[model samples]
Target: MLLLKWSAMGDVVIATALFEDIAQAFPGREIHLNTLPVWEGLFVEDSRFSSVFAVDLRARQGQMQRIVEWLQRVRAGHYDLVIDLQCNDRSRLLLSLLWLVGCHIPYRLGNRRQFPYNIAPAELPKPVHTMTRCRAALEAGGISATTPRPVLSLPQFNHARVDRLMKAHELREGHYAVFMPGCNAKGYLKRWGAARYAALANRFHEDGLVRIVLIGGADEVDECQAIAETCGEWLVNLCGQTEIFDIPLLCQPARLIVANDTGGAHLASVSTTPMLVICGPTDPRRVKPLGDNVVTLQADLPCINCYRKTCSHHSCMSMLTPDRVWQRVQKLVQEAA
Candidate 1:
């Protein structure tokens, strides 16, 4: 079987429940996943997947040749089945090309559409969480996706890596809180502003409680740095220092994880750690991180969940003040105690 999830989508990346459902249904069958080259390391080490094909969609050297070669490889495999978790235009194009080349995959599933997958398209209702949608797709194939949450397999190497990162940052297990304030370029509007983050850090600092660790990608370094500057001794900016794989492992000991509607929160959700996801323009029902411990706080506003990448007025996020979020945090802390 071939499973194609060939993008750097964070939400899709953390959809572990769907993977579990497929694994359960297939049982002992070999599961081959196609993903981007950068994400190959994530699944290649796992025992659940038999093979990982790192497809490079952004081939600069031999673009057309690469596609032909990849398609030829697909033809050679003569896959009896295809599970398209990607469910995007690109995947559709590739699948159509393969069909044109006479690669007949009798069984195809995932996504709600019928073109690529004409047989038993998933009939899930709207206003559902990401896991629910993924589960419905698998359930159509007689797969039980009762497992609501996702999990990651941390290798022995990550233990040492975690130790190195933790030690370097003078962090103790379960003694700190992770603050993911910054988001990707695509989600610039999702940010709740640096001033707000600084103010929140100050509030926590005033109480003299858990240490604050601000983390993000290199793109977020400057933004996180601005917040850390105002935070002084209260916050430690480790935005550019950490890797994607490091987040789930590091979140194991977190007292709390407060994140924007980014992948970081989703990564942290798998753990028992308490997380508060700040939903601005994104719909909580559609993409809220999956876990009992994970809670989402969307502002009660008229224009909430606008689903726009850019907003003229980011009142959805800014309207919900840090004080309101702080109250939720205090309640979570009390409950944890």
Candidate 2:
């Protein structure tokens, strides 16, 4: 059996739990996964996967070689079952090539009406979130309906690294709040302004008693740096420093995490860390992280859920002030206390 899912980091994080669901549905059958090179690190070491193969669509020559090699395995192994969780143009092309090579895969499962899929989502529900839709597809197509929690295991090397970061920054465990101020970096509309973040960081440092930590990727270095400077010595800027998988471990000690709709928020979904997700252009109903202690703050604009990256007005995010978020922050902290 082969399971295919090669997408964004957040999507992959959300799908991590569904491996257990598939494993439960098809017991005793070896489950092989096809994912990107970056994500190979997550499932290659995992016991759930019998084998893990990397598929880098970005690299042309490497992708062609891997495709040829994988087709050979498909022909030799005679894998009849292929679950196309990605259900995109890439997976469709792979299936088409397999047919061209005379690899007769008997059972093809997917959510869309693409060719070669014998099983697919049958009358799936609407208004459900993105991950929930994936779950529904699994249930409708005979996979077990159990909702497994997303899990990301940290490597042994990261513990010492995180310890050093804490020591260098003088951060105490469970006494700090993490702020993720950067969005996808492709657009300015998706983020709550860094000015707002600076205000919140300064406010939290002064009154909330919890230390403030500004964390983001290289794309957000400038934003994190400006915010860190504005918030003074109390706020530490660790943007572009920590790895994506290490965010969960960092969040483990966080009193609370406040983030714009970003990858770190999705990475933190596996942990019990309380998170406040600020959503604007993208709909939270479709992509917010699935976790026990997560809350979303969205502007009450009419065009809030519009997925457009570039907007002229941009009030969907600009109107959603820091004070509004701070109110919710206070409420979440009190409820947790």
Candidate 3:
């Protein structure tokens, strides 16, 4: 079986959850995954996959020659089945190219094509979690999904690396809370203000119940600094300090994580950390992290879950006050304890 999904880190993580179901359902079948070059490291130690193909879609630069070359390489594999989890025009085009090459797989599973393709489309349930949706698609293709949680096993992460990070950050052992204050480029409004995060961090710090570690990408450095300024000496800014692959390991020591609707939030959920996800335009029901200990705080605004790209008035997140999130944090901390 060949699985095609590339880029957008969180979505890839969500898709990984269906691997166990696919493996169990097709025991002898070899599962090869096609993903972006950057994510190759993330799946290096994942035993669920037989091999990983790192496709450099960006470098192809819309060149027909490069596309054909890559397509030829993929067609050479003679896959028994092709599962298009990405479910976009590019993926559909690739599937079409595969069909043109006479690599006739008994089944080709993907979203309903907006245009047309050789294989019939499988319609997935709407407004459901992407992970669950992917699992459902696998089920449609005869795979039974058992593990609902996203699977991420990294053998490269050793205690020495963990200890080094801890020592570098002066992180104390025990129950700590992580504060993630940034989203990816798309979901800016989902993030709470730095002051609000600072207030929450101060509350946890003053209570001496939880140490707050701030994590985010380089774009979030300003927000991280702003929170640190208001948080005084209690906060540790790990934003831009660690690589994307290092985040799961960094979050391993934390008991609970408070984050925006971001990749880190999803990572925190898969790390066995109790998580409180602050959401805005995105619906908590649709995209919130899937785990027993995961909770979400969203304003009861009528316009919430709109999935808008830009909002002139972000009252949805603005109204989700720090106190409300603090209450949720308190609950999660208690549950963790």
Candidate 4:
């Protein structure tokens, strides 16, 4: 069996829910995952997959050659089943290429009602959450999909690293809040502002959650730094200091995770910790992190969920005040306590 889900680290984290389901459905059969190079660390040590293939199909140079080579490798593997969870144009093209090369695989499951998919759900409605669509696709492919929650396996090395960081700061488990203050460059509009985050940190501190842990990639260093500088010694800015796999482990002991709608928020959902994902231009219904303890806060506006790249007013985010977010956080923190 071969599962294909490419870029966007958040979607990759959501797709991890299906790994165990696929493994159980096809016991003894080797399950292989094909993803981008950056996400290979997520599944390289996972026991569910026999092999993890990393390819950059979205590269500007040699993209076609890369796809052709990937197709060649797939053809050689002679996979019996191909699960296209991505359901994007590129993944559809990959499925079409299999037919073009006469590489026939028995089962090709996809979420959409499109060609090259021999198996698919009868009606996968649009505007649905990505995780729901993934579940439907698996069910259509005859997998029970009993496990619906996102999960990650923590490495002992990451465990030790997190322990050292927490000890250095004298932070206790389930006493600190994790903040993901930045998103990918393309989703800058989704940010709920660094000043608001700093205010929230102060509020959390006053309310007894003194230690605030800021986690993000290199793109978020400036944003995290701004929050740390404003919030003072309480904020531990671990931005760019940890790998993707370390997110879940760090989040495991956190009392609360407050974040913008970003990939790190989704990665942190693997932990059972209470998380609050602030939404702006993006719709929480379609993109919010998945977990029983996770909740989303979006301002009510006619222009909400506009999905706009460039906006004139930008009220979707600007109007979402820190006081409103703090109210929601109080509930999460109180409940978790």
* Most TM-score-accurate candidate: 4
Stretches of model 1 off by over 4 angstroms after superposition = 58-63, 118-122, 333-337
Decoy 2 TM-score against native:
0.90
- Each prediction's whole-model lDDT (CA): 0.78, 0.80, 0.76, 0.86
Displacement of residue 212 (Cα, Å) in model 1 is 0.6
- Of 1 and 3, the candidate ranking higher by TM-score: 1
Tally clashing residue pairs in candidate 1: 1
Worst 10 residues of 2 by lDDT: 145-154
Q: Which candidate is the best by lDDT?
A: 4
Per-residue CA lDDT of model 4 for 199-271, tens digit only, reads: 9899889888869999989788889888888877877889999877788888988888999999999889999
The C-alpha RMSD of each candidate to the native structure, in angstroms, is 2.4, 2.4, 2.6, 1.5
lDDT of 4: 0.86
Question: What is residue 48's positional error in candidate 1, in angstroms?
Answer: 1.4
Clashing pairs in 4: none
Off by over 4 Å in 3: 58-60, 111-125, 157-159, 335-337
Q: Write the residue-wise lDDT of candidate 3 on 128-196 in tens digits.
A: 666666666666656676775667775565445767877866786655678899887666787888888
Residues 1-337, candidate 2: write the lDDT tens digits. 9888888888888888787788778888898888888888876457777888875666756867877876776666678788887877877888878888888799888776558677777655566676776776786677775654577667777778888898888888777998899966885577888899998887777775557888888789988887877777778888999986678878888888999888778887777777899988888888788776888999898898888868888888778777888889889877877
TM-score of each: 0.90, 0.90, 0.90, 0.95
User: lDDT for model 1, on a 0 to 1 scale?
Assistant: 0.78
